[model samples]
Target: MRSLQPSRDVRIASASGAITDLPENLAELAKNANVDFIIGDWMSEYNMTTRGSQKVTNTDEAAFEQQFVDSLTVALPDLAKRKIKLAVNAGASDTKRLHNKTLELVKGAGLHLTVAWIEGDEVLDIVEACKKEGQRFRNITTGQFLSDWEYEPIYAQCYLGCFGIAEALKQGADIVVCGRVADAAPTMGAAAYWHGWSRNSYAQLAHSLIAGHLIECSYYVTGGNFTGFKSLPQSSDGTGLLNLPMARVREDGTFFIEAHEIPGRGGEVSVNTCRTQLLYELQGKRYYNSDVVAILDQIKIEEGDGRNSVYVYNVGFEKPPPTTKVGLTAFGGYQAEIHYFLVGLDIEEKAALLENQLRQYLKGNFSLLKFTTSGTSTSNPVSQDAATVDLRIFAQSKSRNDLSDANFLKPCFNMVMSTYPGATFAVDARQALPKPFNEYFVTILPQSLLNHTAHIPALDKSVRVDAPTDTVPYTFEQDIELTVDPIDLFSLGPTVIAPLGYVVHARSGDKGSDCNVGFYVRNEDEYPWLKSLLSIERIKELLQNDYNGKRIERFELPNICAVHFLLKDHLDRGVASSSTYDVLGKNVAEYLRAKHVQIPKKFLDRGRI
Candidate 1:
């Protein structure tokens, strides 16, 4: 076995490709070395419900992700020979099945790696018992009680911490599998095990948590999904596919993030890339995980002297809350969508006519019907495709028969030829097929009730871990009053109206039903101007049509020259039930970037634009 490094410093790389990211991620891992641990986070909020549904039909392999096993099988021999430890939350609901399958693969490959799995993240029984005892699980987002839910939950799981994983590693396990822990829990567990840190090491834990968060999404920190991808320096290979990110964490909990220094790799690890990932999916200034609360308001990202690296520092933390978040998924009926194309002249009028016809013919069939036009009409069109606009009609109902493709398509097909001059169905019949929808409900469960345990297959033993009982009563700092220092428009010269993307970079994502958009500037001088320019009112004005008077919360991260805005209930009822065209809220930032905004001539003269 490879001996533990005496330096007490740990290097962890994420091979998490989750659903469709397996093959490429495994290839990246095989090409890199000097990594003490490999962590793969495969579960997402949406996948949990899908896995739960699968469990209902196929109990044998419902909880395990087959793609994770496939990737690990290919990498198992090398990892075993090198003694590199592995931890992953790929076992969505069933760690035992995944563990057994992995053991079979190891036996077949003639390897002796000790594997362990953690349990207690499945809390359906606990939730049901709590309900029986008159405990009404209040919805964290909607402020509604669980008793108000229309459907029965199929599965429920609580977010777990890393203590059980740490224990497994300490007991000589080479690989650890977990269920629905926090996305960053495996990384946190690996760091804690390497350095022997305790639950009370808030600062160290917080830093490690940040490190895990950065790498959890794999290539996200290495220019994947970055808005300013056009501005990032590219290598000679000329491909946008970036090397996955890895963090070299010190014993003191500070870490430098970088892509593998492989020759001809195409991405850079600059401050902008790191800062973009830091703000992704963030709810506010304070980011809460099961382990610690990271205060992102003061976090700093500095460029490193080394190529393709950035130093992350000053990540502040507070003690964790008394309870952790619990996510429950219930059947939410059915939904269906159909698409129509309106090409060339009079596209807007054609779309309006189509919606009017759809409403007249299909109004009573669906409980909720929405018509959205995708593409804008160009004033001076160069091609037919450029002038084409797609009108999408989406409907949802509790009755499966009402949402069936046969019933859903009747109205559209009936009026297709008679609708407009150049209107045609844009999608195939299969695209309009209705699918079962699931509702996501989140609440908090006391940490004490979680019976966390580490089960070692090699030793045939299981050990229970005590949850952290020390609760920290914490309140977020009051929102900073926006008093824009005011830029002298006369001295700055004329302002040019341009899309926000020309002058700034943004990253936005979903946190349940809420969406967060973080916008930042590269230079310090432009920050003050940006701060004053994009106030809550101005941001609302920019997103006026979509804002719909929803609660908008804004926070300033001056250290990073960034502002974060949270749009509550912005995604309807989150990704599972939301009828929005961009289900994951990934496009919110890009949409904002496309909005025309005023840029000062002096700032533009500096020439980063």
Candidate 2:
């Protein structure tokens, strides 16, 4: 495969539009950004599930996508004139229109969609195939099938690896548009593509993931959370942008992230902003990187001579645990809630009486999902001494259940009115409160798991970016390759202990025959035992026990805290494949329970926190 081309002096600029469409501010910000690919993230449910109910479709993100795109589209020619690139994930869930227009520009208009994570429409078909093979799981919220809907997503990219974005550039795509991808994908892809980094080099990959992580959230790195970062130039404006300036440092003992732009409009350059980003979520001894784990203990950052620029070096890494996969969704509903406090001299009696009183008023077709009292915990008790009792009333049913806000309203009203009459108490006549739908997210795993009963040919038409490879062939010591395939994404696995759940999502790495598996796990919970289990040594054991591959090979998993592993060449095409990892048994409910401890009300009240 051709290596990514070098565009070392590449400078990037971006724009962030004001909430009410402040094009000028956006334009100004754009001028200061000096970004290669301008990005806009507009999605109500972006951090939410990608595919779920039809009621809340990708269309939800459509309007914003259009707004941002139109903003860029309007400014495109000027950018083209200045030789600047524009891109955005603003298209969001329903990306058909964005995709169509982008194709028109790159293929017809001669503009580059400067983006990193772009999901091809073809992948959507992968989900259907999963269903046929029984790999697709169902997430009832949106009536969405579990497996990552490879094809349906107008934007279904988890995170863009380096290869593709660089490939697009080499193919002459000046402007690139992407679908749903990790916030950092675009920036990293751009850097690697511009740097001529080979796919095999872990260090560049590390740098790429690091750069991507910082810029991923536009202001997040710049100044969003620079707790003590005031070293570089500071922007006078309170917004993160207003700060002093400096030049940033990198692993090569050199400074990289720069805030330099046209004159002062480029704003302040500072080490503070960059430093905050570098140590944003530093862990003990080790800092996480996208490619190789970094031993933060060995890491260091420095600023420049008489100016703002921070430098990084000596970053180290740790072995990553297996990957886990989760899906995005939009579970829709309109709910009604009632909140009140039970008041009486007797605490337990007040609670019971409130429950009884409410039950009497609930005389309709709708069934209640929950009706309970609060201040019930023992360890961290909500002081109810002065208040007698506090109760919360709620119920949920299908829209077809034909229940309305009135069913809740009337019953709750009646409870207040008649409670004092029967129990002979006071303080009942007060207005009732209203609540919206008890929004819910029913998260399950492995959209589906199945054995291919038949062979399905590849459907490659518009784009021939031959499948990306994130799978790896694992062998313990000598030689053993487990179809010990990759982890499950949209689809849920048997045990919530989904062997590969940590991997957020992955695609083929390159044209290389080896499939590099990409695994992701939320960084907040880096379980020590599990982390230890995924040690490079253990992974070899797991891989060897499963597959018969080149034995005695170490694997790659970076940032076990936010663990994502890349398994290379572990799957077999056609009819010959088998592994405990590859064989899946589906049971949706049990899978959900594993994600959280199911404590009954009794357990919740009686057990310790």
Candidate 3:
């Protein structure tokens, strides 16, 4: 239980989680966090398509993330003054462009900074060549071949390892720009370079990878999107929502995530918060990265010695995966949506009337026409909002003209006077215009085929970083056993019907169209009940309509007392094209948490989660 020595710890802060994150975050962390390096993650599955399209169009001003350059403009002076290093995947589809932008920013500030960029993630042309050579380019989720894909492939980007980032930093790179390196690669690379960890340092690399994953989303580990946010302390401005986190990674690979206490920041880093993030967006116990495969079931998360700090350790690792995952972006088609409000009684009838009319009017005009209704009426309601419900009509088609026709809104407009009582449209005619959506495909390419390179502009040098020589082949379908002390629901003495969130804390996230929700209890005694209660069938039952005909996979983490369920192909085609209301699946956990269940009275005595 020794305190972390700032001199030895490879301190790093997550400057940005996504392209939409504020640019000032980099400056704030650099000016106050006193970290050795700062990292940012700027890519997502949807972004791969958008940025790739930008690149194809030669959109010079937006080929890369402008926010990242803006961030560097504000943080460059502070970073130079403090001699703090920086790394980011903000290059999106154009790493070279971002690299040049960084150099320009440094020169404009009259600062001496060695800027470097990592390349080899982009492989659109290679993938096309391989496809022509009979490489099926099979989809990982549905096992569908690329030939079966409806859209034409536009861009393909692979996930790279941390070696290139490490090599850049080793070659005196003050700023490292990257395109689609694994989300945690920057943190892993920084830790590896700081301790001179070898490529074969699987255990240490795995630990750092987990540490990187914990803080990669920035505010997530600090309290953002956390279920227990109500308990967090509010800032002077009366908002506890905005926050930032930094990690103190030891040479031994152990780390602690703490809120980077700036003057106006909010949020805390506790064991629960850390556990929530650790359980976010994972497929199972094994977290596969380009450099290492982390076995996460045995890991432990605990309260740290300092306030707003959570210690994480005990991670296991194996050699990296032989094939790296790749994302291909293609234009799905055009889509249009309209919302209608149905008030008070006969809500279902109102929705039914509109759906029937719309189906009659536009029956074969679109590829897909879907209707969804949510919200409930309270008995003896106090306000008009209480009795209001939402009915959404979503339509998608291969032909943009199909949805853009003036006749598209005619059915909606004609029914205004003939619709159910208290029915009203939520948007104007212009809001119903068609917008294009991208279809994202997940595949894999052999690591040996990639030419990962690290280039240092200041030194005029390029270092070739090869993929890992030692690797283990892995498949997500690998049999992972689940063992637990079974608790019979009927045998439990008495039960109180309440929302599952009363005794369980859960986190949910998306991967493509698939969603994973991990549920954990507050104490060990409640774990057995959690495991016994949340079966694959039970999860489908709780999900109700959303679980219709979709696959569900369940796994257990006995060490953390958690049960994880992966809902395959649940979000349609992910955030960009998903028709579901919970597009990113962020709300799936909350929705499941709200489902009432028969809970043991004994657990209720212990209080809410």
Candidate 4:
């Protein structure tokens, strides 16, 4: 591929296989449209660990920014002469290595470019600071940070203010790299800065988040997937990271987002595509419109001369909160399973018979839960498994526990060993088969990422893990201290096997992004008093305090069983759920830690943690 001069303001060419072959097509499109900046959205989470990609330094993470740099290196000469600026937002999780390498990439090519990190350390620092303050749990919108310890950005973007880009151009930066800015921000900032718009201009920001969302995907607004298959009219192209061309600059220091396609690409934009984009960015719990304002509800659309343009105004914007987001994934090893089918004149009796037979046949290696069969829609069930009351038993331990423990699973032959009258075995499938092990992805709010806040109180409460009782009203923090030695933390009062009350158990399945942590308990009884002490607040408190002030307390640890605690302060309805009632759940975790020093006096006369 050769670099060619498309205009005095911008250079148009293909990056060959470096960035992608699409650059040539982009060059043709940019030449057709009066465009200034050519942005390439590169990388996504899956791209991070794309296995053997040269662009990424860490094999676990995808190397997209490198790809972007390599692509630009090919056209550096042409880009330098035309004063065309290249921008990309691709290194959201890779830290500064990607950003620094990009600067070096351009420099090595004899080109000088300015770089901005929108995600990485910027958000990490903020999150850490916020956590130190009071941020807790993973937020669905605005606050949640990147997951996938190692990942590639699906849409890496500079999210530069439209005007800011214009200035960077003036500053003579040949290229710009960013993590995430508003999609339209780069374009808007470029336009606004070039047009000399003020930061306080509400009208301009409103245009930005709207235009960003519109063209952030680039061609989506340009008629890439604008297809109204059913209506066969003007529709939106559901293409990802499509370029939008309605980016218009006005003399009044303001701009308008363009919803048009390449000048002569022969595509159609309509109310359908425009509205679809609106609905597309509406992921997470709610849509986070950039740092601007616009009357999205009042958005008007019109198509003229084969061009569908959206007239947008009055958009509202908010500054993102400072906090670090942590994503955790619980991966599984292996699993073993067994299936049993029982038949009888009484369905319930047959199911119960199978339970008894397995209990005696395999001693006590299984649990019996009535197979819940409801919500059966579709032409057939999601899986091919037949029979309504099939016992789905599973086991992980290979010891005697796996074959005969009360908590373990039973063997397949157990079914035939005690088959009922009409319990004829159908298609003899793998009877004592195995269960597929899966991992769940969940986000954690660690103190380090939450702004590094540590606030510990006096440790006047203590208990032993071996000691047992019903009521303690002690507080528990989700503080799983690595320094305290898990055994001691539990032995102090009652180290819990599971946090009591409502403990959110999330696992990554088909459609889940991360294993979510939230409340699952319906009542307080499921958790014994001592088991009900764990809570997020208490964890935060212990993290903040770290056994500093309030007289040290103590507790005890359990041997074969995990001690569970019920939280009082930390566990609340989702803050967005509107049912939190301003009640801050803090006691659960605090009481557990408080018992760290005084529990022996309260429950055990001689126990000490």
Specify the highest-TM-score model's number: 3
lDDT of 2 by residue, 208-300 (tens): 455554454445344443332333344444443432122232322123555434343223334435543443322223333222333443344
Ranking the candidates on TM-score from highest down gives 3, 1, 2, 4
lDDT per residue as tens, model 1, 274-313? 8888888886877777778888888988987588788888
* TM-score of predicted structure 1: 0.95
TM-score comparison, 2 vs 4, better candidate? 2
Clashing pairs in 1: none
Q: Candidate 4 lDDT, tens digit per residue, 54-137?
A: 222355654445555555556555555555556555554453456566666657876544544333222334434544677543
Q: Best-fitting candidate, measured by lDDT?
A: 3
Alpha-carbon deviation at 421 in model 3, angstroms: 2.3
Candidate 4 Cα deviation (angstroms), residue 592: 48
Error of 2 at 78 (Å): 3.9
The best-first sequence of candidates by lDDT reads 3, 1, 2, 4
Model 3 per-residue lDDT tens digits across residues 125-215? 8898888889987776666788988788888899999989999988889999999899999999999888888888888899999999999
Once superposed on the true structure, which residue ranges of model 4 sit more than 4 Å away at CA? 1-32, 43-63, 70-78, 99-134, 141-170, 223-227, 230-246, 251-266, 283-290, 293-295, 304-308, 314-609
Q: After superposition, how far is residue 536 of candidate 3 from its true place, in Å?
A: 1.4
TM-score of each prediction? 0.95, 0.52, 0.96, 0.45
Candidate lDDT (C-alpha), each: 0.81, 0.38, 0.84, 0.36
| CA shift of 603, model 2, Å | 40
